[model samples]
Target chain A: MALTLETRDLTIRFGGHVAVNGVSCTFKPGELTAIVGPNGAGKTTYFNLISGQLRPTAGTIFFDGADITQLSAPLRTRAGLGRAFQLTNLFPNLSVEENVRLAVQAANGTHYDMLRPWMVRRDLIARADEILDRVALGNRRQVTATALSHGDQRKLEVALMIALEPKVFMFDEPTAGMSIDEVPVVLNLIAQLKQDASKIILLVEHKMDVVRSLADRIIVLHNGQLVADGKPAEVIASPIVQEAYLGVAPGRSAA
Target chain B: MMILSGDPPRSRVLSILLVVIILALAATPFLFPGAKAMNVAAQICIFAALVASYDLLLGYTGSVSFAHTMFYGIGSYAIAIALYSMGPVWAAVATGIAVGLPLAALLALAIGLFSLRVAAIFFAMVTLAVASAFQVLASQLSWLTGGEDGRSFQLPELLRPGTVLISKSLIGFELNGRVLTYYLVLIAAATMILCLLRVVNSPFGRVLQAIRENRFRAEALGFRTVFHLTYANCIAALVAAGAGMLNALWLRYAGPDTSLSFTIMLDILLMVVIGGMGTIYGAIIGASIFILAQNYLQALMGAASKAAADAGLPLLPGLLHPDRWLLWLGLLFIASVYFFPTGVVGRLRGAGSAKH
Candidate 1:
């Protein structure tokens, strides 16, 4: 069955401030939804809520028609919700290959087996290498994660997510720090992952061109609320986005 | 044979150093026949294993648990109590081990679940409190634990000093129970250390390190960080208990000063950091260096003081006095930390790798 996620009246509060006010939406498989909004518009907060990093003060999240509002982060990930941070979180001291290998090992479900050596698990290592090569990081597999450049670090993050192969792929900002040359590698990789008919992709991207080229649908968030939800062209042309997000006067045509 | 288990010391110099320590410890019963020498050697072996197990937590998993020695003391106390109460039978020793290990695991599981749900610091503080409480309880329960005096018990006939294994003497040293006890401790410590090496090199060990490196990433990758951390905690506890059993078997006694002291915990921290945090080989080197220095460095300083006095150097003798050995040891630790900030094993491995 295709994985579906729906949030109803999802809300979270920090010191009486509703960072993510009552905003609910449904996510379906085979749709790459680009969540566009201004800073602090509750896009990432919504992602965090769905990903189980922060508890919703007053709301419920559903996954595959099952309530997952209280599932822990790891449980959520195990249930096929994978999230990548915008800041490129990784095992900074581990070798790039080892980082991916660990993710693969984690997915393989041998975290409790202490007798067997990890080196003997050639399958996991091979799988990690395959993921690294796909992201063009095969050459730097031996390099420590902290030693990588910002762009390569971002690539490593994606490599780890790929290694997990979760059903729901959440990218906070995949190309947040990429230089022009590094942007395409990640964008192309996402495009490749978008090919799978059963995966649901959610992206919080600021670059409109990246969103337009990649997003199957766009949901505009403003002031902790879902202001608009529709196709990228309509949402971009929508007066709310045109005025609040693009900083253009409402009803103005694209320049 | 894969001498060093999972990862082979990585540096030839480190490998050589480890082999030397291993060979020396193995030969302690013969190479050093005197009682003092035998005791020191056994200590090196036991503390080496003990420190290495602690490294599994502090180094590999980045969890600082002060209750390590509490589990260790439990092992020692369990053996001591069993032997005292059950008449020094081999089954009693077996029973002690069988009972003590699970107890340690269960207590670790309990403490881990109770505190690991919170932050890392919370775990540290909770373990600290629990360890001290356990220590206090052990001391106060004079009826069961022998109170402040601790428990001194008889060993099985096979482990007694007078029980000669072979009448024939090899190079003047007889294969007796005393030697048997030393060898047993050595073998036990070495095997446990090797097992720890294997565990750390396992995929599970990798998960621990990944958790140490970045808990969020590990969690995001679908690893139950708390469960892994708690399992790691229990594994460390088991090995620590094994080390404590070796201590009891060799010394034939378990006391607050010998087994349950906070100083031993501090010593473990010192050994792990001075040896190298993440590397198991660091444990061997750290334990050997610390214990050997503790045993001999004071005398060495006394000699320097004598030489200085004989030379009539002003203020030199007083400054280098034997009583000031702690100051000297502190200075040496500072110097080691300064020169080998990553610890000796890390320095040695880094050098060997840099040449390539």
Candidate 2:
């Protein structure tokens, strides 16, 4: 597998606190890589740095073998990095279809057409409908994004991400606020992205079962540093990973 | 009707009403045959275009700019000075537009590029500061702008009020310069409204509305948000300059009070608020209602004051004087805001969806 995204000594600091520090990794195509850590382990911060939401204090990010360290968020998005935020970020006032349609339009490069009516773009609308149906929000296409249930908004977020046709997908806690039954639906959707042989999927998830079932490899972080990186079972059996999660040595019991 | 079949029935009805209003305005000078009525009708046309252009920024793109009137003033002065210096020819009018539009676009670009870096409220404040500075410059540049007096110059023979287009009466009114000028304003305003309608329905317009709804989401979706906003600002400035040029030609003057005054900006704000912010048709409805009220309210107040004085009530007449009509107008504005929060068009469209 070729490397699709790579980071070298990526570092970001907020005043006296170091959110992400000197973490380096390479993501390969067709790999479902799960990044897991204890609370405040800088998982989301690292995701933000890769997605261009936060600039690294000192580091270089290479996407598809090109340096994109200074690219802004939108530029990075256009450069084929798609991100679904932890909190459902959407155009709340627009309809669900409009939300996806805008993403599709952005992907199609029709966002700058100042004279033609948007409805005239049947191809974009059809693509938007297909993406909506895939995300299972076709029935509620006319509903405002804010009016959708929490689970549906998450799905809409996924729909928006998929519409971008990204080379790499970065999902920051896709199931953060989802209910129990809704979890499998999102996990299934994330799992489906593996069908594309040239795409890389990075998931930041807290659900251990989801990581165990879907991830091809597991990377663990503790205190803003990568602690373990290997197959899921191997990483899970590592003492450092066990100590980071259990807050003690593997054989020690809580008093 | 077929083109509007996809729209809600209410929108269809509103569109028809707008066409009717445009036709009514076109027939105003012929039907009334009075100079005062013709003047009022011309004002409605000019302001309808002006308010719609302002909505492109404030309503669609979600940018509040206080420098709008400054652009309008620039267009007026550009034409006035050109006509004054080069003599009244069609070429001079074209030159004025050539000079004025780019000037407005450049100013808008500079302001948008610099001030757009700030937060929304801060951007408005920056525009206010810049607009005030531009007003002072207009007042001080006496040689070009005629300073406080402003400039009035010769118009082309076809535009002059004395130039008769037809020998005989048409519909019981002579086809003279006033009528020709009225139709000129009418055609210009109507064309602008049509072009703007096309723009707001375009994909570019959707991106603007998207930016207004959630800029972060828009940018995250791969939109160059700042560029779209700056483009919108330039288009708004260009349309506003068109309206200003028509106004200067109609009035044959472009003074600080007429063109660059903040009161015109306030009037535009009030029109957008009262008519409805996001809907393009709101400009027409709002401008007509406000301008009509402004024209007649003083006369109504004067009549009441005279009636009171004739009835032997001194203090009541003073309170009812025409000079205090603004107090009444202010109250009306407050009442409109309180009652119609979303504006007249918003009310007409209903509560659930007003963005269209």
Candidate 3:
């Protein structure tokens, strides 16, 4: 695996409070990296910076050796950076399939066709169907997005990201609001992305079990600074990580 | 037969209804055989095109613009000025179109580029301010716009009301200039409607709908939201300008009352709401119904007033006079809004789905 995305000295400030400090990190292809931190530890803000949702006050982001720190969110998306929001954001009036179809069309550069009927794109629809079924939303394809349950909306959000087929996936709490029963369904779906050897998956999660089970590497942040970065076991075992993040003594089970 | 069966019954019914409406519009002059009827029909055609153009921005793109009539007035004034300066020839009409469309496009582009940076309601306010300014300019610039009186000029021979295309009558109706003008309006309106339908059903239209639904989601999915909205605005202005050209041709005048009035803009908004905002077919239905009611409501009120006067009710006659027709129209609009909150087309579609 090679380094596919790297951020150097990334920092963002809101007035006097620094949300994301000058932290440097690298994400490699074929690796699932979990970022875990306390509530104000800047985990989600770091994801926002990499996905171009927020501009860094000081830093540079390189994607596949190309500088992308200044790219707009849509242009970043076009350059193969896909993201799913913490909240379920979708077109409420459009059907589930139509929502996925839009993502597919955006990925395929077919959304700009002003003369041809969208229904005529058989390939896009087929791809949308495949993604829908993969997310277990095929039966509810015709239902409007807002009509779905919270868990299903979360699933649809992932389905939208999957349809984009991006080289990098930045998921901000994929199972944030899911019911206990629904959480594993989303987690398993995300865990399946590990099969793709060329894709880089960066996830911001608070669930320790999920991070331990799915993460190939774990990065822990404290007070907007990187406190630990290594394999899941090594990072979790570090006395500094245990004291700063886990609120537990070393050699004790934090979970 | 297979292809015929392939279409859902609702769509088949809708298509048939559309054809019927088109045919009715085409034969309105012959069927009614009166100047008032011809004028009403032409008004319907022009406003339908205008309202449909407005829908592209208001409904599909989810933008509210009060400056739509400014573009409409531009079209009318451009044609009027061109015909007045040049002679009544084909070249004059060409000049009108050439000047009107580009001017409208440029104005739309500038407004869109500037106002699109603001919030949605702020954009509406900006357009309102600019539109009011344009109206004032049109009124003050007497040399160019004929001030409040507006400029009336001679049309080409073919489009003039006196020029007869045929020496004899056809189907008991004379093939005169009025009939020729009616057909020209019909053709323009129908073409505009068809083109708009194509644009709305295309992939580009889908993106507009997505943006309207959730702009942030659309942007996150890689749409250039401002750019798409600006382009949609330009298209809307071009179509509206076409409607204005038709209005100038039919009326043989481009007065402030006819073209640049805020009343016309209000009427457009009313039509879109009454017909259904996002449904393109709603434009024709709304325009036809509203125009017919506006034209005949006064006459109906006058007749009622005469009856009341003959019945020795002086106060009743005064209250129900034709001048008070707006009160009746206001009540009717209120009732329509109450009954059809989503507009007539939306209610009809809801009913159709419920039955299914």
lDDT of each: 0.90, 0.88, 0.88
The sequence of per-residue lDDT tens digits that candidate 2 reaches over residues B40-110 is 99999999999999998898988999989998888888899989888989999999999999999999998
Tell me the lDDT of candidate 3: 0.88
Task: Give the alpha carbon lDDT tens digit for every residue of A77-112 in model 2.
Answer: 999999998888999989999999999999988867
For candidate 2, give the lDDT of residue A222: 80
Model 2 — TM-score against the truth? 0.94
Best by TM-score: 1
Q: Which stretches of candidate 2 lie over 4 Å from their true place?
A: A1-3, A246-249, A252-255, B1-17, B168-171, B302-321, B351-356
**Candidate 2 clashes between residue pairs 3 or more apart in a chain or in different chains:** none
* Per-model DockQ: 0.84, 0.72, 0.61
Cα deviation of B86, candidate 2, in Å: 0.8
Pairs of colliding residues, candidate 3: none
Best by lDDT: 1
